[model samples]
Target chain A: MTATLSRIELMRGLVGMLRDEAVVAGIGNTNFDLYAAGHRSQNFYMLGSMGLAFPIALGVALAQPRRRVIGIEGDGSLLMNLGCLATIAMVAPANLTLVVMDNGVYEITGGQPTASAQRCDFVEVARATGIAHSAWAQDTSDFVRLVQAALERTGPSLIGARIERGPAIAQPPRDPAQIRDRFMQAMGSRKGFGA
Target chain B: MPSDSAWAGVVLAALRKHDVRLAVYVPDKVLIPLIDGVHADPFFTAFTATREEEGVGICAGAWMGGLRSILMMQTSGFGNVPNALASLAVAYQIPVVMLVSERGSLGEVNVGQVWSSRVVAPVCDALGIPHQTIERLEDLAFVVDRSIVQAHATQTPVVLVLSPLLTGGKVFAA
Candidate 1:
């Protein structure tokens, strides 16, 4: 699919579908877009790390088997830790969903071309890695449909949304501890906070 | 109580006492018994990581989810995971407990293993992550428990380097 969808719009759709589900956003634009689209206590934004959203979300999914967990990562960040796809497949937690924003460039780092910009197919890689519910979102509508399916079905789904080059609309809170505390409280894992 | 098996049991008990629910590891000869013990127990989730970085990622994620986790690797494997430790665990202040098997030390036969073992401690020092070497069986309980507790208390990565003298190292073909 030719990637022309706006990352911000897609992120908004993702946020709109969640009630109490947890979201782990990768570093850079993926984190910024999620915070810009909407901030929730359930969201765990990465401020420094790349290629870790999937693993973090996998842990959340594993710990809270009934709660849906979404991992949002950029193509460049995902490339850095591609083994996580295989690890995710190995554990295959049904409550997790992986959403990769593929802009084909490291947008936060001066727009350097990633492997996806050349010949990498993330959906294919995810599928080969054993995540059966892997696909490319054709557009915004398709993205919403896939997300709806992901939420409805018991699957470790991977959705690779090819996005247009752009900047994140806003920045998230800079404090990592505050972000961690709120998310833990939202998940009811931290005692006496939101409990 | 001076045997490797005795010390391994002590380390395992301390981990359980510290509420470590997940054990993420890359296979290593010195860690086999400890890995088996964690896997056999119902209280822990035993994850076999394809790479050391993946183990670090899993531990980081588990910590964020409020489940205590530990990462197990050999000396050489430590070289593969510093970026994740520095960027994800350290920068994000996610406490990580790493149990690394000392290789290339004492009677190590492999040239590569020896060279890499020398760098692990220096690397941990350079990363500014506190590391302790456990050489005697009696030290297992204190070192293991304290490192895990201190990691959570400080919200930073901590390493426990298991010396060849403690674990008997891994017997090599060469």
Candidate 2:
């Protein structure tokens, strides 16, 4: 019940909560962990981009208002574009949920300390930025509860999960085109190479 | 400002004809009329981005989710988002239509804006995105219309650099 659980376990709990919601995973371990949960066509795996998972998820949320969209990013990635928090707040898409994995370090890059390691609170930041449904899940059970509650809510939600560090349990295939096309197909908007 | 920024109207019309419904922009003086035009229209979903990179990411997401979009920023704004362009837009082949209003090449009074104007081509070239500069109203109707189609069809980001001659550039009062 204590906080600082494995990211893969957190991702598994998150993956279990979804019922066809599109997941846009940020680059690095965030993406790899999502793949470890299971390769759902509904997941969009970011390759080289940093700090864009939330922005991309906002786009999908706006595009398909009927379908829920979740953006999963790391603290390092999310901090790269904090301005997006304002944009998400302004738009206030009811179907979007943001999950920021706060590992306090860049786990993929040899555990380099990030601002989160220095006391930056993403939940407080999200709440102050006008996201009314922001919270820190203190443990695996609380993570599920927050995500479940977020799904039932009516506005944009953000969950800051403080996770334990470890190597990615698995990595997604390196094929960007296949990942994109497959996701498009799953979204029911597949256009091959240019349809 | 030009006594008539009739070109903004032309650009607006081209955007409408192309069915680009989502317009994410970082407002600029030269591009304000177009920004206002999109906001005023019911057919478009217009939003302001705090930075150009955020705008690019939004456009990429919109495209993936089946809504055609444009990312509008002035030339200087484009400089702040080359990484987003290279990583998200170009790397993923999202085909975001980036309309940049040129500043440095014209009678630019600000030293800050000059570098972005020159850097766009080489930067875009490095990302393998094809860029074209359009000056004059007569030429835009065709270029704007065709390039948008080409961008979507090819799955590549197309940078249309709008010249000062066309937007009347930005003016500083004496």
Instruction: List per-candidate RMSD values in Å.
Output: 2.0, 1.9
Q: Please, what is the whole-model Cα lDDT of each candidate in the order they appear?
A: 0.86, 0.88
The candidates' DockQ values read 0.61, 0.78
Please give, as one word, the docking class of candidate 1.
medium
lDDT of 1 by residue, A56-164 (tens): 8887888788888999999999999899999899888889999999999999989999999989999999999999999999889899899889988887999989998
Could you tell me how far off, in angstroms, the CA of residue B101 lies in candidate 1 after the best superposition? 0.5
Q: What DockQ score does model 1 reach against the true complex?
A: 0.61
Predicted candidate 1 versus true structure: per-residue lDDT over B1-174, tens digit per residue: 234477778888998898888888988988888999998999988888778887877777777777898889999999888788877787778888999998887778789987877777787788889999998887889888888888998888998999878888877676
Tell me the docking grade of candidate 2.
medium
For model 1, the chain A TM-score is 0.97
Supply fnat for every model shown. 0.51, 0.66
Q: Poorest 10 consecutive residues of model 2 chain B by lDDT?
A: B1-10
